[model samples]
Target: MRDDAPHTSNVPYLPRRSVHLDFHTSPLITPIAQQFDPQEFADRFARLGVDSVTLFAKCHHGQLYYDTDRAERHPGLGGVDLLRSQIDALRPLGIRTPIYISVLFDEHAATTHPEWVCVDEEGGPVRVDSHGVPGWHVLDMTSGYRSYLAEQVTDVLGHFPDADGFFYDICFDQLSSSATARAAAIEAGFDPDSPAGRLDAAAAVSHDYMGRLRDMVAGDGHDGVPRSVFFNSRPRLRLADELGFSTHDEIEALPTGGWGYAYAPSVARSVIPIQPRAIGMTGRFFGSWGDSASIHPAAALQYESLQMVSLGLGICIGDSLPPAGRSHEAVTARLADTFARVQAVQECATGAQRVAEVAVMRAPITGGEGVIHADAPGAGELAALRLLTSRGIDFDFIGPGDDLAGYRAVIVLSGVGIDDGVVRSLTLHVESGGALVLSGLPDDVASLQPLTGLSSADVDGFAREFVRPNAAATGLPDFDFVLPGAVRRVRAEGDVHTLATVTEPYFDRTPDRFSGHEYTPAGAATAYPAIVARERVATAAFGLFEAYGATGVPEIGDLAAATLEAVFPRPALRIDGAAHLEGTLGRRSGSSIVHLLSYLPSRRSSADIETVVDPVPALDVAVRVRLDDRSPRAVRTLEGVELPFSVEDGYVHFTVSFDDGHCLVVVEEE
Candidate 1:
């Protein structure tokens, strides 16, 4: 195990370079693993710099790859223990093999035992594919499928006692209306008829199942070797509640595979704090899993892998094995190049710790109604990340329960529910000299009076309004710009500074009152304030974060950046470059490593394929790092090239040039 490898109590260390091989062979397919030469398989993976490979024990097609009597084996395997053979081959080569098992979406279990199928609210079987489509069906985890899965797991454990670990897939909320689930919900004192109650019941089942599975794997038979455990398909945002179930996080965000370029960074930032020993999973396919023919461009793979390592996390490239069990030449070759790039900067990224200056609340603090819950990142959370990233501002996502003392500013997005606890936290943060930025109107304005220094008034009673930035509003146009969302009117009390004011239109665009072809022009400037700031706290009456996400208006992001600046003027780290050049700062040992990524994805075809063909043009980058009073011993690239530098105002200022997709700069402090 390397020093840079991610580790947990159960799993002491995980390989930095791993591969997730998906082998979901249908029962009808012929000669599964028949052509699989153990040596060839091992040689290919070892050649590609893979230290760990997740092999399949069972797949969504409901067929086991290994020789098993308790479950239906893949007919194509012809009584071959494919799983065991692969492990036998890889283990001797010093490669760890984590066996994968499908949990909920099992076609065999659902087809043969229809009684175990998950029932949806409409009394129909819950499924991933629509009617007449050929795909796996969802099974009720609280039904007989629970015992069935447990039995299969026991069988696997009994056979391969020395297996490296287990990777559980499709472990998420399988909300059900089945009799068993309904009865369990009732026994747990929840109204199964309600959507919220049903969701809660489902979450409880998932949590319990996860605990049982974890205990079973950790139970006696490991031969003293610690085994890793992970559950895929669970929402990353909600992992805070279920951290006990897994040893590490395998974030599966295939950028070109529908999880866009922004998804990986946003998810990694949120999940890394809780589970630092994590790996970012991206597929080799340009599209997604099972798209074997259309491979990812070499540039895309390099960008994805470098981005993951840059964040102080390991990288895993996903690939699928053909039924004949031979590795694809093209995929193998491309991966070799990508892995080499990762190895180039492996030393610099080894022990780096990301430095975040601001904490963006994932959900608003609620009084008791509970904060927002979603299977994906909330609009405000994702949008806020994009805004900050574009401006070269570093941040992390935090829940209400997370500590705020380490952060310089806290951003509360729109559409969040507020409670007294939230109000107290914000108030304390502001009073302690920390900054607070509220995106939109909360349910109750009076609750935040201490922070906002304003009282609840009335709505602006207009469909839309224009914002005119005063001199106090820095970096904004003095002229009016369209503010495109609902604005909550508030009366400024005490000593509050108005950064911008609202200008209402002459009249509503009614049938009788016609203006230009579109919205009415700005007519009168009102006393209402669009932005207000009071002693380390600022409020944007409109849902700027949410609006910016929904509509990528340039003015909206500009306003957000300026508002953040007004509250927290001195960020810990600042970078001056093209907006597309994403910067990530981290500390390791006696130095800090700054990762600059400069690859821009392009949609080349009508099918919406995001590909990166060429490296970015030569970019001149300037970085300002706050070292306080300590002087910099040296500033150099990871390749050991010393660069010219200067010090001023307790900060080290340096400049470097990089045209490559990724660049690593190390700053040594004395």
Candidate 2:
């Protein structure tokens, strides 16, 4: 498939503005949904511009919200049938209602049937945390819980035939040493006794059940339309392998909930190339789920929502419905305002594809664990997100499965393992005149020596070093710049140009030999090259990406950007603006949209929470878009205000400004 082509599937239409309502009611709570007024509830969502709502069918508490004879309903619900009522209320108002089901963490099941609990290799039951604390227990899917889950799902399907889709939560593999798991592993041709074998077997079992559940959902449709199926909590790194079990991708990244703000954009960029129709899920609370009364700032919501839509992704704001089923007034108000802003730019963002000329290989996960969180933003990935986006360089996070032919440049950050397939693809890319940039050497550096033109690449025995750009290097100071990270020593063979040299520190910081408070200062310049280039391939001795992520160093970004520009001079998009501004270019058949967002988040309190409190000031931004031979018929904002532009050397140049933290400009073809 072409990189820009839409990922067409039989899934239901994805709503731009949606809500994931959590209703994990405890059995002790009485009179659930007692205050729920169907018309009022549906009206509020419609007024907020919400087109879809995911209501809970079964929650982690193992309480069914709908009327079912095969399972236990929340004791507080009485005869309310919360899920049915929610669907009936919203469906008539032209709102899509998707059902949510908890797959692994079921409190009631774990407490009632001890045999159904998942067991670790150490013979300990798997759970969220200590048993003394209040947390959900994981149930073994290979055990009897599988039948119970399937029966409950079938019941939901039969009852809510009009539902638009299904969202399965906690759909990750678990390492288990149970009898059923061992037997299933053996049947699947895997040895259960080996740790690697057990991990593989667990993933196989999870994938099998997910596929079966997806088929079941697909088989039962609403009229002639197919229902969307998404297995939440699956790792983004393995999306290529698990895409078969999902109809649409929904990234559940609550920034305040342990996932930093960079996680969503990194994951979204990676996902949209594979599945254009995807949702970026964030939460309305200040922290994570279960924070009922707490509300995030309106500015924060606007920043997140605008950024998501700018990337051509649907927006889903996560929320927890209180026991009385009343909406949080303050939170809903902020959401209503944010949704209005999103609706305003829907015209420019609706069908446009992300225009990227650079592909950065995402860093591999630590430990190579089978059951990993969906959003694993490594230091390199986070730096890539910061550097690329801030520089207004449109790019995408790629994996081994992605085709490198579509991009003009491919960047392999440090810490990303290079497998045979990746090596082959990158070699082909470089041979075809595409730019190839690499950071510090990975474990498989020997395999790429010929391509990199490096006679030797080894780690220098220095904890910290400095980079000194040569006189020929542009946009870099002549003085040495501190690189507070591990440095690698490299020697280029024949026909290679040295961009920068290494400046070694006096000594490694020891308890007794430390020079300063932190580490030693730079001592002397070494002949070993810090940055080198052969043809279109550029190599860095240290991980500029990693250093930038670990420490907010402006010099690192500048050097990285300069190196990239040296090799990949003509990018798809470039914006000259403040570092606070992030830009993305989106293109359709005849027009292109340029999205500009500016927001600075800071630590608000003593806690680690970061929030945006001030509005962005107005500033003009100069932009250059590579349109090749095409001429612009019109250049205007989404509001139709025309702007003057000129095309020079294959780039269409224009300037735009905004004061409300987000701006979108449209360029039409003649």
**How high is the CA lDDT of each candidate model?**
0.80, 0.81
The alpha-carbon deviation from the true structure for residue 623 of candidate 1, after best TM-score superposition, in angstroms, is 1.6
| Cα RMSD for predicted model 2 | 3.5
| Worst-scoring 10-residue span by lDDT in model 1 | 365-374
What TM-score would every model get versus the actual structure? 0.92, 0.92
Candidate 2 clash pair list: 32-76
Q: How many residue pairs clash in each candidate?
A: 1, 1
What is the alpha-carbon lDDT for the whole of candidate 2? 0.81
TM-score for candidate 1: 0.92
